[model samples]
Target: MKKLTILFLAMVIFSCNNQPDKGASDNNSEIASQGKIPKTEKEVGSNTTINDYSQVETEKAVEPDTIKTNDNQDINYQPADNNNTNQFEDNFIGFASFYMQFDKPKQTFILKADEDKTITCKEGTKLTVNENSFITSSGDSVTGDIEIRVKEYYKISDILLANLSTTSNRDILETGGMIYIEAFSNGEECELKKGATIEIAFPAKDKKDDMQLFSGNWESDKVNWILKETIPVDSEENAGFTFVEKMPEFPGGQQKLMDYLSKNIKYPTRAKESGIQGTVYITFIVNEDGNTEDIRVVRGVDSSLNQAAISAIEQMPKWTPGKQGGEYVKVNMNLPIRFSLGGEDFSTNNIDYAKEFEKQVNDSNLSNTEMLEISHYIFSTSKLGWINCDRFFRDNSPKVDFLVNIGTSKQVDIKIVFNTINSILTGSTSGGKYIFDNVPTGHSVTLVALKYEKDQYYLAIKKTKITREEEQVLDFEPVTMARLKAEMEKLNRI
Candidate 1:
């Protein structure tokens, strides 16, 4: 009993020593869990969680900063022959920054849907990033593939870069468009180009490496490049992949205003010295015509920055303008006007192509044919005059019309009349032979000759006006050819 008690006491002592200091250990554990203690495991966690939410929190530990870049001045880089540089800041967006100046790494994503869940990304419609990643799907597809090309910093002259900064203006991070939601459908193939949605989580960075790369180019207002899929994606309801939908300035989006302010609104030197690193949030009404009619501070920056920001806001062109339903309505814009100077400088091209267009117009004239006509005066002539109509030929006077047949199947029917002293034979075949002499001396006459078909004259001669009618051509040649005229004369002449 004594030995057993001594052993038990030793065991109890060992247990007590091994036992954690209840209060201290508990507090330490709590502190450790609270992230006061930054550990490698906490910084880069192993997401072996049964639930997605827990995994997401762990993944957020290594999340990159959500810094927003400025895009307002991007107009300076607009390609020639383009007009209205992103005139309306539409949902279609474009963005640039030092990060963009950095090399854009090719990032890929693949979703392995639950199984046999049919999800199709239609041609123009895109299934973009979702808020979470619990793909409830069977047949999954590549909803959207983005190849974010980050610009390398080499161009901005390293001299100024060291002074460049990641700003306290957190708004710069707002427009990273880093999150996306794709569509998972047991429904019909989702139409592309149409706005559609399905939820996907921004996966842990390691899982992102597992994303499949597809081939081909996909130009979205939000993203670009081929998915470059290495592995086939599965489609289930919540099993699909979710990427960052935070696409850079998709044109026609309101965030552009923020992006502009984030970039252009530098911290007033005075404001900075005063320790005001925060931004001024401005919300203005952009009318349907795309002008900022009213400017109000959603959050006041200051008198100097506020007025400056307001002036800048008022100078802004018409926005796409947000809407609650289908009607144009006023919306609030939280534009953070930071006094950041190290960001990119975007300039608008002042090269006026319109001036060039004006020059081109000044050098030339354009007119549509309004009226076209050829006046005709039928002349009745004697037998001898009609026979010598060929002698009165003219070339290209408005009075002479010859170019009836241009080529091949293109043919024009012609009509004409021979004017002589006798009005009796003025008209075609029925008029028979007529006589003529000299054309009026001062003027020229063209013989309006007709090419007869099947011995029947369809219309008046379509050649030219005959002017040599002062005398007569006693030498007569049959208008219908000599042989045919001879046969007619022999058979009918009295």
Candidate 2:
């Protein structure tokens, strides 16, 4: 009996020691409710979680500081607490911190969505760091902080377009743009170190869907992303598409079109002798039937050269029409015809042919037809004579300036016509100011401003006389919010 009692007491003591603490049970239940399991002591630095405590080599445990980095400011070399081993559930989100400097290591900012607060990070999240380089519109290497602002969250059901920032301002991140992202298993901020790199994953089955994971750093409105992975994406095609899946092609291809242009185009004798060598900009529509029509010269160098281009296009064979959403659609295309005097034409000439042609056109006092011919020649050779040709011949032409006042709005378009000796000169405004360089004196000019208020057209007109060699200014009434409201009220009554 004594031996049996001793054995039973030993067994009871063993069971008591094996049981989990009551506080621990409550903590584990809370963690499971949040959709996450706590990492075991052995898994602290493994690839399973982002908050890998193993990556942090602390000599001893210490209290962490609550330090906040300034948003949109360059982070200096101040290290935050790295010893925190707190873990987060899968629902938490991590934002990519695009550090301004190129050489600095990138970090991820973590936030608990349900709690709307920061979370602890673990180490050992798979990290794949790669050096990336980008060029700007000015051909300079990007060096500023790239800001990425999350405009809206579509809750994984609708399309999501994030606002990617530039040095000047934030613009919508374009679909199929280079920016991409992925999420890690663990979502915690403390896992990220000052210089540590993280792995990126695209968890979505369909990468083409609107919403996806973006993991990387920002360099002052410039995005220096290292990885892009997708989340679970819907299979249905997005409702709208701005760009076609496949662009329209010529019957034989682009090479064939080039060959046709080269074989068919003939230089006009007038244009050749006058040294008119430039590109004529032509725009046309390729119909759903693949036939080309509505050919016009948007920017002309010379009439003869423009005619040559138009004739070539009119004789072109049917092309392979563009398709949008699996159906053939009419597409507008722009083509430039180059009229260069090269290869057996002006190869041996000593004169600057282009300049000589301009001078010849300027010196001539010809009829309107002849003036247009010269204008066409100049325009085709160098895109120079797109405006009124009469100004080149008249020495003492009057000038008029339209000073438009639309109340701090530069989005309005202003148009004016100065009539002189059977010729009408059209001038448009450049940022609320329009200048008519050379107009014949003693002629009546008409000015018109078209303002659209809530899709309704408002026209303002003024008639004035032009004086020779003198500058004239005309101001239009400002379009104010009050005026627009009054106009809206009147339209409602009607």
Report per-prediction Cα RMSD to one decimal: 39.1, 33.1
Task: Give the per-residue lDDT of model 2 (tens digit) for 1-494.
Answer: 11000000000000000000111123334444534332111112332222321122212121121111223222222223443323211112111111111011113322222221211112111112222222232434333221111111111111111212211111112121111212222322111222222222211112232222222233321222222321111112321111232345677765567567767788787988876766676777676788888788877789998999899889999988766558876655667555665321212122232334333332112111111111010000000000111111233444444344455433333333333321223243465455444344565655544343322223455566665444434354434333423432332221
The candidate maximizing lDDT is 2
Across 1-494, the per-residue lDDT of candidate 1 in tens digits comes to: 11000000000000000000111122334433533321111122223222211112222211122212133223222123434434332211122121122212211223333322211121111122332223223434433322111111111112011111111111000010121112223322221121222211111211111122111111110112122112111233322111211111213443454344434544455754564332345554444444565567655546776776677767665555443234444332323343322222212122122223222221111121111111111111100000000011222422311122212211112111222210111111112333222222332222322222221221222223444333212211223222322332331111
Residue 439 of model 2, lDDT score: 41
Q: Identify the candidate with maximal TM-score.
A: 2
lDDT of predicted model 1: 0.24
Off by over 4 Å in 2: 1-175, 178-243, 343-494
* TM-score, candidate number 1: 0.18
The lowest-lDDT stretch of 10 consecutive residues in candidate 2 is 6-15
Q: What is the lDDT of residue 126 in candidate 1?
A: 17
The deviation in Å at residue 418 for candidate 1 is 62
